[model samples]
Target: MTKLDITKTNRAIENLLETTENPRHRFMLQAYYRHRYLEIAGRYEEIFAPEMMVENPVYHFHALGLNVRLEGQDAIKNLYREWSETGECVMYADDEEVAVSDHMIASKLTGYQFKPGKVLAAVGIDVDDENAMYIYKASEEMVWPYDDRCRLVGEDVWEVDPDKAEIIKLDPADVITASDARTMLEPLIKPLPPYDEAAMRPRATAR
Candidate 1:
């Protein structure tokens, strides 16, 4: 919510793609930013329309705590169309990667989470080399489905799919990697808060 988090997110994205040397990854990352910024800027028509979007786009995710896969441009367009009348959504993530091959690029993402609006936190998306494919994911650390991005079976309370039912996971511990003694001290070595030591240091006195 603070001004710092906004600037921090943009810088984080730039840093994430700084090391990628592949041409395909570079181009995709560029397009990713362009399309995303367009959405964030309220130009949803430019990217969500049938002509702008790829054919048969598939949006896969857990809906109302169930794995509900939304397919085709219609699914993505309709979702945005409805939200656009209200307020479209946007998402931001860090540590994003694009692994390139001869044709397709697979993205490895973390820190997924989504805010309200029509933003699609994409992931593991591909539609052949000749076709368009782009996947996004919010920081899993904070994103949730409360906005009801996925269609609910009924109104009022949320219903769970018995076969694939689950609830929100907002706690950091939920996604922590397996820990051992060596890694346990990570917090100890973590960088300290920024400081102004020059001002804090005692002024030299004439002696």
Candidate 2:
């Protein structure tokens, strides 16, 4: 894992936004910037958790303002019904018990709030309703790789595709700067420290 220079990356993005003119170009730039932003924010690694593997598979869905994680074949059946009935298929980790409504899925998934129609102005983006589109598009591009633990192991892993997983790749683009981003994003996205280290440390033995 490399460190990232979040400060420099953020400033550069701001600078690019300030000078860019064309809306289409600006949109692409913003997508790239936001992608880097999420990368710096460590959204990719946490969501993927490549180091860990899941054993028993379970599927969960959030819709109609309800959150449910189901076990066995029935889980998929319920998820399909929900999607067919409501046209909502946004899913999150079943282990976390996170409610879809509690946090904006875009922000949760991407690590940046997409406020449409509001321009930083300083960044030169119209940012109005287009912000929604930006986020949706970016989310579509972001990918994650689930370990053995994922319930839908054989299916498409939205978070792991190259187009979708570009954020993770950002770590290797620039060594020193990337490390900084990793350091910063790790706390925000994966605040909890690894338990294995603590569990493995030698305990004081009684004399």
Candidate 3:
């Protein structure tokens, strides 16, 4: 991995934060910055490694002051992967991410965590207060992909003729196949090299 100009990088991000974010989001962004820098320090081989990515990760529930059980990361990670691919993100109450896995892995993510504005929004998606929802879904849906459901259709429009419209239902198994999964994960798992100043200077996306 290429080494970053640490002092320069810190000053740059601090300036970015000062100008763009609110106080509440600052802490979240700083934490993301540190974690992102750590991954950068490690050159990201471990961060994206399947054997290491979720290996005993501490899944913290911000609202509950709790964490996932030892083996829980397996289910949680799977839920995360599926959610990243298909869940509709909503800013619920104060929560920002509520991933609706086909199996409903968790519920009531009251104050979810998404990536920050920088470093891929800190690129991690986590949920809080999630256990109750995992218990609500029938077990078979988790195992067999036996149930297929349609997403909300024609949400913003005022009126639609029901007779002419049809919603296409997708099967997660068919959609998240090997090729699709790679396509979805490629960007997230890309290497985190030091920023190339000219190439990465915040521009249109920031505004």
Candidate 4:
């Protein structure tokens, strides 16, 4: 995947939503787009809004021969909060394969995570200066399951090609904390209609 471009990536999701016609698929995509926007803004509450996800959502994460399963909203939210404390930002590449169905959506893409050198080193990455920043690029596959109401059930993610992952040291001048990125990107988020289960459901047709 190419270098991370936050503006381009968010715009691609908007374009996809505009071109997609299926109601169910559109519901799922809307939820996902909102999730992505809020995530970059570090708005965890909005990302996990009551109408957007189930009560006991689960997350399966796999990487470096380690598998961790987090159950329930609090667990997942805390995990994200912990990552935020380190001031990291994640960018999803727009040129990736995506498949949407009635109850699930799957995608394979290369993702880049920008983290401070301290955070990277704690994860076993060698760093010359703890104050420096680095980018970790990896191939990622995600499976998102949605309930009948279009609420996300859970996320199943895998770092499929861990061996190919690259850690690149960033130039000092290019370094930006996640907090700064949130401020820069929050303005790009657009408001959408609240999630309505009745509106998203398929209505019965006349014979």
Candidate 5:
């Protein structure tokens, strides 16, 4: 019931990469960027790709009156599995602001999540049709911390304005499954080169 044009998102990231000159920053972004593509493709195994994360990875989602934290790889994996299966993660962002450091990547954006009317109803939103599609929009920020190896350690997400979140119903024709999106988006995804410390190191001139 949710989808994204992966081609478009890929191009956006490529453009950002082109403008970013920091080797470490580019390295970290490139290292973790493939997860979303694999997620869309229903390839969760590749998303984790052994050593992609630390032994105990955590994800904290702070929204509205709720604070949810998923700890450990299993917990994180199960959540992603649920999102992929339910198509809840089929969303995009706008006005994105991203920053990188030796150990973290911070992002702020206006995020839009697509969901079925039924899902919204379960959350106490009144919907006229259970089968109808609806989109929820909110401003969000996420802090991603990685290890020296550039493996992700955890994520802290803040829903900046959940109280002001908006839900808009969409036409029935807008319905699209995550699997279908993956099929359409996979072709446009360009694989990043394998990690090479030598390649990722900041040059002496840059230092």
Candidate 6:
């Protein structure tokens, strides 16, 4: 994956959100902002690996402040206990309106594709690209799973339940809408900052 200039992207997004008028345009801007957020959060496997819980105790997706706390043995015990009582894992969707299916939850546990629309709704937007057709088709890959209880397994592998994953496939019309939105609002989007020479300087070695 190519490295992204996050600071620049954030600035540009802020600018776009500030000046955009058309609803579609605003949506596309929000999409890019959401994309940047995920990129900084790291890949799904790295963030949700079970082993990470031992050291960090909690994996916090900073961009959105959504986190999963790992309580070691206590967590497993509680999960089993809850399952015994309720006959299901104790999981909740970010949006009450968006139901969490078994497949969705399992997918999250197994490091499968996670959709962002539900979480974005928490920040005040309702988006679903289920047809995999959006104007800015380039961003589809940036989306990742947002698990409430991600258990990491090994260095690069995770033990996610395929049942818990949510898929957001966008149709061709959706893509056109997204693109039209961006075009209408591009002028309002924020421009990136100029380069800083001092910050780019190499460190001096000790004599």
Note the Cα lDDT for every prediction shown. 0.34, 0.31, 0.27, 0.74, 0.72, 0.30
Error of 4 at 62 (Å): 1.0
Comparison by TM-score, 1 against 6, better one: 1
Winner by lDDT between candidate 4 and candidate 1? 4
Off by more than 4 A, model 6: 1-162, 168-176, 200-207
lDDT of 2: 0.31
- Candidate 2 lDDT over residue span 17-121, tens digit each: 587553333333344334344444433322223222133335443321225555544454454444323212212121111111111111123222111222222
Across 1-207, the per-residue lDDT of candidate 4 in tens digits comes to: 233556555555567777888777787887887777677657777767777899999999896345999999999899778766665635546456777777888887777777788877777877888888787778889899988778889999899778898888888666556676687778776665666655567444212
Please list the residue runs of candidate 2 whose C-alpha ends up more than 4 Å from where it truly belongs after superposition: 1-5, 45-207
Q: Tell me how many residue pairs clash in candidate 4.
A: 0
Residue-wise C-alpha lDDT for candidate 5, range 105-137, written one tens digit per residue: 888877777777887888787788877777778
Per-prediction TM-score, please?
A: 0.43, 0.23, 0.23, 0.87, 0.85, 0.21
In candidate 1, stretches whose alpha carbon ends up further than 4 angstroms from where it belongs are 1-12, 48-53, 63-66, 94-207
Say which prediction, candidate 3 or candidate 5, comes out ahead on lDDT.
5
Error of 4 at 57 (Å): 0.7
* C-alpha RMSD for every candidate: 20.4, 18.5, 19.6, 2.9, 3.2, 18.1
Name the regions of candidate 4 deviating beyond 4 angstroms. Answer: 1-3, 196-199, 202-207
TM-score top scorer: 4
**Candidate with more favorable, higher TM-score: 3 or 4:** 4
* Winner by lDDT between candidate 3 and candidate 1: 1
Q: Mind sharing the TM-score for model 3?
A: 0.23
Predicted structure 2, TM vs. truth: 0.23
Predicted model with the maximum lDDT: 4
Better of 2 and 4 by lDDT: 4
lDDT of 6 by residue, 53-82 (tens): 233332222122233443444553453343
